[model samples]
Target: MHTIEIQKEPVELYKILKFEGMTSTGGEAKLLIGDGQVTVNGETETRRRRKMMNGDVIGFRGDQFHLQLSTHTETI
Candidate 1:
C-alpha cells in the first residue's frame, strides 16, 4: 500500500482519482464514474464529487484505497 497525505481532512473524488493517476482530468473521472467503473465501499459509485470521508474505501480496476483522516493509502 502506498500512502498519500492530503492537506485537508476530506477529499473530493476527483482529487484522489488524479492522485492515484486513475485519470488526468476531472472529465475523465466523470466519464469513468458515469460508466460505473468506480466503486465506493464495494458498490458502484457514479457521483463525480462524491465526498471521500475518512475511512471510506474506493476501488477501481485492480486498485483500491483507504481514505484515512487527512491521508489516503493506495492499495495495489
Candidate 2:
C-alpha cells in the first residue's frame, strides 16, 4: 500500500491518477477510470471526476493507495 498526501480535501480522481504518475495524461486516466480499471474503498469507480477525500483507498492496476490529508500547513 502506498500513501498519498493531499494538501486539500476532495481532489478529483483523474487528477490524482495523472499527478501521481499512474497514467501519462489526464485523458488516459479518464479512459482508464471509464473502463472500470479503478476502484475506491474496494468498489469499482468509474467517475473520472469522483471526489476523493481523506482516508479513501484507491486501487489501480493492482496497486493500492491510501489518501491522507496533510496536517501541516505552510505559512509565509
Candidate 3:
C-alpha cells in the first residue's frame, strides 16, 4: 500500500496512475482505466480523473493507495 498526498480532497484516477509510474500520459491512464485494470475502492475504476479525494481508497495494478489531502505544511 502507498500513501499519496495531494492538495485537494480528491485526485483524479489518471493522476494516481501517473504518480505510481504506471504511465506517462493521461491518455494511457484512460486506456488502462477503461480496460478494467484500475480499481477504485476495490472495484474497477472507469473514470480517468475520478476525483479520489481525501480518504478515498484506490486500487490499481495490484497495489492499493490511500489518498490524503495535503496541507501547506506538506511538501511535494
TM-score of each: 0.76, 0.98, 0.81
State the TM-score for model 3.
0.81
Report clash pairs, candidate 1: none
Candidate 1 local lDDT, 1-76, one digit each (tens): 3444555656888778886787988788888987899998899998888888777788888777777665445679
Q: Please report how far candidate 1 places residue 22 from its true position, in Å.
A: 1.5
lDDT of 3 by residue, 1-76 (tens): 8887877655678977787687888888889898888887878878777777788777776788888877667448
Mind giving the per-residue lDDT tens digits that candidate 2 earns over 1-76? 9999999989999999999999999999999999999999999999999999999999999999999999997989
What residue runs in model 3 are displaced by over 4 Å at the alpha carbon? 73-76
Candidate with better lDDT, 1 vs 2: 2
What root-mean-square deviation over C-alphas does model 1 reach?
A: 6.4
Worst 10 residues of 2 by lDDT: 66-75
Top candidate, metric TM-score: 2
Task: Let me know the TM-score candidate 2 reaches against the reference structure.
Answer: 0.98
Instruction: Kindly indicate the candidate among 2 and 3 with the higher TM-score.
Output: 2
Full candidate order by TM-score, most accurate first:
2, 3, 1
lDDT against true structure, model 1: 0.77
lDDT of 2: 0.97
